[model samples]
Target chain A: AQKVTQAQTEISVVEKEDVTLDCVYETRDTTYYLFWYKQPPSGELVFLIRRNSFDEQNEISGRYSWNFQKSTSSFNFTITASQVVDSAVYFCALSGEVVFGAGTILRVKS
Target chain B: DARVTQTPRHKVTEMGQEVTMRCQPILGHNTVFWYRQTMMQGLELLAYFRNRAPLDDSGMPKDRFSAEMPDATLATLKIQPSEPRDSAVYFCASGSGTDQGGYTFGSGTRLTVV
Candidate 1:
């Protein structure tokens, strides 16, 4: 069985501030995938990033950055200089045959 | 760019009514997934198919929900007698393979049961 835990249910930050959303997952499979998705108010899920278990290298894309630590079983996402448009529910998912996650709500206020 | 498409973006029904949602995966994609989203349960995978064959549906309630891919391009999710608790936004996603970055999602079908 695989499980994903997003500890923070909700977070609020002022615009232009940096925020980090925490995610931890448990899986016995040697090969699996981790993903981050954003659901805005419009209710559309936008894919943010995807990392396989083998790749421990951290990734940065524009204003977004992800740290994948295998030792801690954590994949954390950070948004730098966030804007009001960044307000959305973020989900961390673990996938093989089936994917699962609860998600974290982030509010970026001006 | 190719994209997944869903029909009946919004649906409202009473208890005991039948509801069906449809999805069209991106052309050439071989896998499709159905998911339910709610405030309490962020996202739950109901069923998925590969090569138009049912792969796994362990997350679905067998008594009321049925998922099938009749052909290559279309996938359908049906609820025979829906309850208020079944109300949530249903999402359909597709991927090229089992790879990490293969998936792409549709906007979703918002189903409200009363």
Candidate 2:
């Protein structure tokens, strides 16, 4: 069985604050993929990033960054200097019939 | 641009009524996925199709829920005798079914069974 866990149900932060959303997953397959998606109030899911299990290299794209650590089975997302537009529900998922986490609701305030 | 399309955007129906949701995957995409999202469940995969064939639907309720891909371009999910507990936002996503073929999601159909 594959499972993804997002421990934080909700987080409220002020603009310019750096926030980290924790994600942990379990899977038996050595070759698998992990993903992060953002769903705003508009109800559309926006793809953020996709990381293969073999690559543990931390990635940075603009103000959004991801830290994938195989040791902890964790793939955490961090937003540096988050803006109000970043407020959304973020989901972490494991691929191969894609299993999703419970998601973390992020509220960025001005 | 290429994107998955779904309808109706929102549906409110009485309990025991049959509800059907539709999806049109991106052209040339080989895989289609149906998901249900709610406050409690987050997002759950109900079923999926590959090359217009049903792959896995273990997540769906066999008795009340049915999913089908009548053609390569179209997919449908039907819930017979829906109950209030069945209310949720149903999403349709399409992919190439490969590691790099990240899924592209539709806006989703918000269903309210009262």
Candidate 3:
């Protein structure tokens, strides 16, 4: 069974400030996929990023970045200089025949 | 850009009524998945198909839910005698392969069983 946990249920930050969303996962499989998805007010799940177990290298896309740490079983997401558009419910997910996760709601205010 | 499409974006029905949701996967994709989302339960995989063949549906409630891929492009999920607890946003996603990059998701069908 693969389980993903996002400890922060909700987070608020002023625009231009940085914020980090924590995600911890447990999986016995040697190889698996980790993903971050954003659900805005429109209720669409937008794929933000995907990381496989073999790749430990951190990734940066515009103001959004992700840190995948195998030792700690954590894949955390960070927003640098976030804008109001960044406010959304972010979900951390593990992939397989079955996927599970808890969600984090992030709010950015101007 | 090709994307997955789902029909009847919003549905409201009384309990015990039969409900059906449909999905059209992007052209050339071989795998399709059905998922449910709610405030309490973040996301749950109900069923998935590979190459139009049912791969895994263990997550689905066997008594009331059924998923099928009748053709290459179409997938359907049906709930017989639906219950109030079945109300949630149902999502359809497709992928070309089992790998990480092939996945693409649709907006989702909001089912509210009253």
Candidate 4:
């Protein structure tokens, strides 16, 4: 069984502010995958990042970064200097059944 | 990049009407999935298939919802006697069986039941 939890239901921040969306997951399988997806107003889900259990390395892409910590069973996403265009519903998911979190609606006001 | 394709981007139908949604998975992908998204329930897996065989459909309502993969590329989800509660964005996704990476999702079909 796998479950994902996103504590933040919605978040609002001014433009150029850094925001972090928290994600926690529970899975019994030693080999599993974690993912983050962004659904914009256009109604399309955009893949953000995928991290496997073996790789605990934190990844940074442009203004976006992900922290995967097996110790805490947490995978967090951070957006540095977020812009208005970054507003969207972000979901955290666990693989091998692909259980998704409730998602956090982010609003980046300019 | 190859992507999954879903037909009937938007559909509005009267209550009790039968609604059918279609999907075309990326070529060479062996796994396909169907999901429904709504404000109350973020994303729920309705059904999934692997090698054109139904893997799991326990998430779907067995009475009125039916899913099938008639061929390698095509997948269909039908809801008979659709109700207002069934209105949601249905998404189709595909993944390479060998890849551990996440699946690629389509634009989704937004269905509205009046």
Question: If both were scored by TM-score, which would come out higher, candidate 1 or candidate 4?
Answer: 4
Question: Each prediction's DockQ?
Answer: 0.69, 0.75, 0.65, 0.75
Clashing residue pairs for model 2: none
Model 3 Cα lDDT, one tens digit per residue, A5-98? 8889999999999999999999999998888888899998888888989999999999989999999999999999999999999988887753
Q: Write the per-residue lDDT of candidate 3 for residues B44-82, one digit (tens) a residue.
A: 899999899988998899999999998997999999999
lDDT of 2 at A98: 83
**By the lDDT metric, which is better: model 2 or model 3?**
2
lDDT score of residue A66 within candidate 4:
97
User: Which sequence of candidate numbers ranks them by TM-score, best first?
Assistant: 4, 2, 1, 3
Candidate 3 Cα lDDT to native: 0.90
Candidate 2 local lDDT, B1-114, one digit each (tens): 888999999999999999999999999888899999988877999998888899999999999999999888899999998999999999999988754557999999999999
In candidate 2 the C-alpha lDDT for residue B71 amounts to: 88
Output the lDDT of residue A41, model 1. Answer: 92
Cα lDDT of candidate 2 equals: 0.94
Compare candidates 2 and 3 on DockQ and give the better one.
2
Q: Each candidate: what lDDT?
A: 0.90, 0.94, 0.90, 0.94
Candidate 4, superposed: residue stretches over 4 Å from native: none
- On residues A1-110, what C-alpha lDDT tens digit does candidate 4 reach at each position? 78999999999999999999999999999999999999999989888898999999999999999999999999999999999999999999998767899999999999
lDDT of 4 by residue, B19-100 (tens): 9999999998889999999988889999999899998999999999999999998999999989999999999999877775
